[model samples]
Target chain A: MVDRIPILKMGKYLLLSIQVDMHDQLALDLQEDLTEQIVRHRAKGVLIDISSLEIVDSFIGRMLSHIANVSRILDAKVIVVGMQPAVAITLVELGLSLEGIATALNIEKGMRWLENSVNEDEIAGEPESDEDTDAPSETGN
Target chain B: MTKTQTLPLKQETDIVIIRQRVRKAAEEARLGLVSQTKIVTAASEIARNALIYGGGGQCLIELANRDGRAAVRLVIADQGPGIADIERALVDGYTSGSGLGLGLSGSRRLVDEFDLKSQPGAGTTVELWKWK
Candidate 1:
């Protein structure tokens, strides 16, 4: 029902901003859009800013973890930033960890970090660009 | 925006429209992405609880004040069996139903403010708040 979830483009990267009133469907939609964007743009990395968000359930935390997995497949790194203290605690209780994913102070900091990483490394360790991260390869999604 | 209001109960499908409306409000207000995500996450969980547990309820999203600062107050209320045991339900891995049981307790961890009220078959009401 969210007519359209806004897609904010930051250079080759995309900023997916979502404000959902319900917790379940919102998580589903976000997961869908993020996966599509990762492939559509072949983005180098993704930053999911959750500052204004009010709640995050186990499903979302799991979805985010899944996003990181697929992102790695698409050759992109994902950083979840601006997590509210409460959301942080919930994820902790659920024992949800971002693993190798990075989190920044805020969206601005996230962008700055990515920019610097790209500039300094000359895009070193570029993740092999694959349009579909969900597709089952000889490996996995 | 400062008014304290209670919304009418609706269904899970209604959440999609609510999500879009909230997202639009956030964008127009220039809350940025971080704010948007946080809002969406909390809203979705609370709304779903109302539909699933409350036997259908209303969603209330208001611009309220917490200690005199701008804040987002979200509430999903249902007149279903109120939570009989709040403490037990809060414990991680404690589930009375077949679901993961993270819906209430897990969501409690997801938002800045979480409040729940349940009294047997009477009903249940939950309140969650997140600020800039």
Candidate 2:
């Protein structure tokens, strides 16, 4: 049996902290399960905390991008948070820019970004702004 | 300079083992945390290639002295079908498999030294070292 990555619901957002190094199958399972969680919860935002993940290979890199894309289609905003400096360097060196994915230095910043975006969606009177934006800022902490 | 540990790369689970071994080797080599992280991440990428693309292989982690500097070296060899074009394979965003095409090139960029050797129907061997 494949171990399921836990998806915790926080208000209108879903939070997932990847503490263990993910196997290929586990990463795939997380992608599928997370999408389902987003749809089920009808969440407005997703915060993925990866501080505990020491390395992110191409597969995991693609999975993160895929999650962001799918969540967008499902009308949920996704914010990736807590990427280690080394992991970020390796990701860029690996050529997986994770372009079109929003990132934050920590969960606190991610929450703030999500809050502002949600407010912007409300203010601009747009459908949550599928504007393909980058991270609000790179604390790189 | 020649102390080394070997791990078989026959399955997916071996990836974690390889990473752990690389981490231990890096620690023994006295690399800084950032250096250790880079090497481990590089090892993870190459080990995955050994299992998925090469159809399983073996990895050797070594503590070596390069130009009188301490370094951790990782050698991954596979017996599967070899890559047809080495240059194209090393280019970023190029993959024959369904992956993101970041395995070879990405691993190369992460380490201080990278070497690749392969021939059709023979096999492939990748050597990487990060000096401390």
Candidate 3:
């Protein structure tokens, strides 16, 4: 069996810390696994820690973007955190800006961002003032 | 000049090996963190192109000197169907395969020197040099 990266579940979020130097197949497997996990748990957000990766080539870069897009379709947001400075420089020089994927400096900050975004989403989804005014009048009666 | 080591580019794992070897050589040559990362990333890109587009091949890694500066050189060759339009292949985002098409062009940008040689049905060879 091909080795798989473990995904941790934290409340409404899923976390993946890629500690190994992943081969192409391994990366693809992670992509498949993460998406399935998102749907299974109905995760609201995902945090991918890539600080251990020394490099991010085009293939892996595309895989990250693919995961982000796929998770978005599943109603989950994906955030990549802990990218080393050298890897960041190399990735940009390699002509991949990794556009459309959110990034954070560390896992702590990533979780905060995820939590804040989820909260905002909840606030935006709440019933408007018309419903709130009705609730106050009903309580008075 | 150090001895050249050749590794097969037959599978995905081989690409990872190439990256590690290239990074070691780069560090030995005293390349800074970013330069080492660049060469390693470039090596990975070309190596994958060889395995995927070239149907698997071989890579030659060596340490050399250019103008009295130490450098890491890589020659990746494949015997698959060669590219007819080298210029088009070098263009950004022009991949004939399932990739993002940045492997060839982007790798060129990461190294100090880049060379490509290929002919239709004759195979492809890419030489990259990064100086320290």
Candidate 4:
């Protein structure tokens, strides 16, 4: 199996590119890899681009949570980008992002979110970002 | 003896792998895709349930009754604490874990024949059959 995941260094942030087919356990590996990169680089932010994923299931959902959790511990903010509408709908239904994992329009937006978060954190001494920031409100839209 | 296979978790995602491998093996044995998908869905759902509620378990997919109808049997077993109440678990919408909880009951809806066994503090085993 070819590994379609890569970690690219752009300034202090790592743009982790993942093109996943049938995203199941593959997400787990990606989570682990991203966590390692966060620690190794002592980097400030992450941009995980998963636009190529076809299906997002429970495992992938869990992996995203895991990645966000670990990245926080490493003092690096994470921004998830390029989610398909189907995946977004399913995630809302499943309520995975009840813990605030940022989602931007694309990799650029994610990177900017992380960069801003990192800059803000450095100034304010890393206030708790608070979970559920990304959660869908009860409006049920 | 034919090599026995072990699956990671009884999950919808794993179902994709199960169907693909089962179909490949079935085609090697001359089985078609339509029947394979139906049966695998039923069996995979049961297996997936075992993973989530049973404290996580694996799916044991194997070939059985290569003679009669060339059927493949998948035994999704979990080592986690078993379901507290069997009958309630079978009831639709009785979800304890995450997602839709459509796996256990939905799996029952998919396969030709479904056999479910669970013992609290022990684990769970769901046997599903797909016939060609």
Candidate 5:
């Protein structure tokens, strides 16, 4: 049986910590499952902890972007936390800044970032327009 | 000195195996954390290219010492339709597939040395080297 990355629900946020080297199919599955979980739980933010991930290839990179984009469409913000310095350098070298996605140094910081974003969204009043304003321009049709 | 191991790139599972083998080889070469991550990431990109774009081929991982410096080398070759423009293919954000077009250019940036050779209707071969 293919192992599934566990997604935990904490308050209004969903937490996913990737501890394994993800294959392409698994990445796709996570994308599908995470989006579904977001809708079911009506999560306001997602914190993906990748501290254990040794490498982030283009496929996984794209998957992360896809997840962020999809989550945005569903009215959720995504914060990718715990990315290794090495991985970050490699991604930059690979020409992937993981643009338009929020990031933090660790899970603690990630949680704080999510809290701030949720609060900011609440204060913004018109959540729909504010989120639309932050959508990655290239992905907007 | 040089030691080499070859793996077939026939399916998705093969890509996983390739990454594991590359990680082991990098360890044997005593590459640091970032270097190891870079080489492994590069290897994954090219191996996937071999399977998806090249229609499956083979990968060779080698540990070598040049000019008294140690390094790991990867050679992923495919016998597929072949690329018409090697230059264009290496450009960032230039993909013939659904990918973000960062594989070739990004992999190139990850290693210490890189080379690519392709002939239309024949095959494509990518050589990557990372110094320890």
Candidate 6:
């Protein structure tokens, strides 16, 4: 059986940290799984941490773009984080600019960006509602 | 021009193996971080093309000297329905398959030397070389 990259649910967001050098099929599987998870959980944001990936070829680059695109259609914002400097240079040299995908330097920054974007969307989506003006409800008991 | 290793490009998982072997060879050649990454990424794109487009093939990793500088060379060959229009195939966003069509043109940009040979009924061979 092929190993799968696990997806964690954090409130209204889904987080996936790819910790392995994923084969092609594995990458496709992650895309399918994440899309399903987003719909099932009604996730508003997604964070894909690729810090462990040493290389990002055209196939993987396309996969990332596909994931971001699909997530956006499902109303979830996607943030890719922790790309190595060398990988960034190589992707550009390889002609894969990875356009349309939002990126951050690290997981912390990615989460913050996702949170802010989702919050901004909520605010923009409900400008006329006074009850939703204060802040998003905290996940507290 | 001593050949270091030869790997089969029959399956998708083999692409990962090819990337690992190429990376090791690049490190052995003492290439810097960015160059190593570039060569490895180039190897990956060409190797996949061999597997997907050229059907199934083999890759030979060779450690060579380019003007006395250490260099790593990868020769990926496949015996499948070969490409007839090499010029059009080299164009960016010109894929016969469902890829983003950056495999050939992008690989050429990443390496110091790129050579492609293909015969319609014979096969396709891509030679990628990067020097330290």
Q: What TM-score, computed on C-alpha atoms, does each candidate reach? A: 0.54, 0.90, 0.92, 0.55, 0.91, 0.92
lDDT winner, 1 or 3 = 3
For candidate 3, lDDT tens digit of each residue in B97-127? Answer: 8899999999999999999999999999999
Tens-digit lDDT track of model 6 for A1-141: 357999999999999999888889999999999999998998999999999999999999999999999998888899999999999999998899999999999999999999999899888864423354567568677
Interface DockQ of candidate 6:
0.84
lDDT, candidate 4, at A17 = 63
Give the CAPRI rating of model 6: high
The window of 10 residues in a row where model 4 chain B has the poorest summed lDDT is B28-37
Clashing pairs in 5: none
Candidate 5 local lDDT, A1-141, one digit each (tens) = 356889999999999999988878888999999999999998999999999999999999889999999999988999999999999988888888888888999999999999998889888774543344655548647
For residue A134, model 1's alpha carbon misses the true position, in angstroms, by: 18
Instruction: Output candidate 4 Cα RMSD.
Output: 8.9
DockQ of all predictions against the true structure, Cα-based: 0.23, 0.66, 0.80, 0.10, 0.75, 0.84
- Candidate 5 matches the true fold with a TM-score of 0.91
Question: In candidate 2, what are the lDDT values of residues A1-141, reduced to their tens digit?
Answer: 337789999888899999987888889999999999888887889999999988888888889999999999987899999999988887887778999999999999999999888777778665443466645456767
C-alpha positional error of residue B64 in candidate 3 after TM-score superposition, expressed in Å: 1.1
The C-alpha stretches of model 5 lying farther than 4 A from their native spots are A126-141
lDDT of 4 by residue, A1-141 (tens): 445477887777888766744434555567777778777777788887878664444455567777877888777788889987655654443333426677887877777788788888779754444455565447756
Report the backbone clash tally of model 6.
0
Task: Please give the distance, in angstroms, between residue B13's alpha carbon in candidate 4 and its true position after superposition.
Answer: 8.5
Candidate number that wins on DockQ, 2 or 3? 3
Please report the candidate that would top DockQ against the real structure.
Answer: 6
Query: lDDT per prediction?
Result: 0.67, 0.88, 0.92, 0.65, 0.90, 0.92
Clashing pairs in 4: A100-A132, A100-A134, B10-B47, B10-B48
Each prediction's RMSD to truth: 7.7, 6.6, 6.3, 8.9, 4.2, 6.1
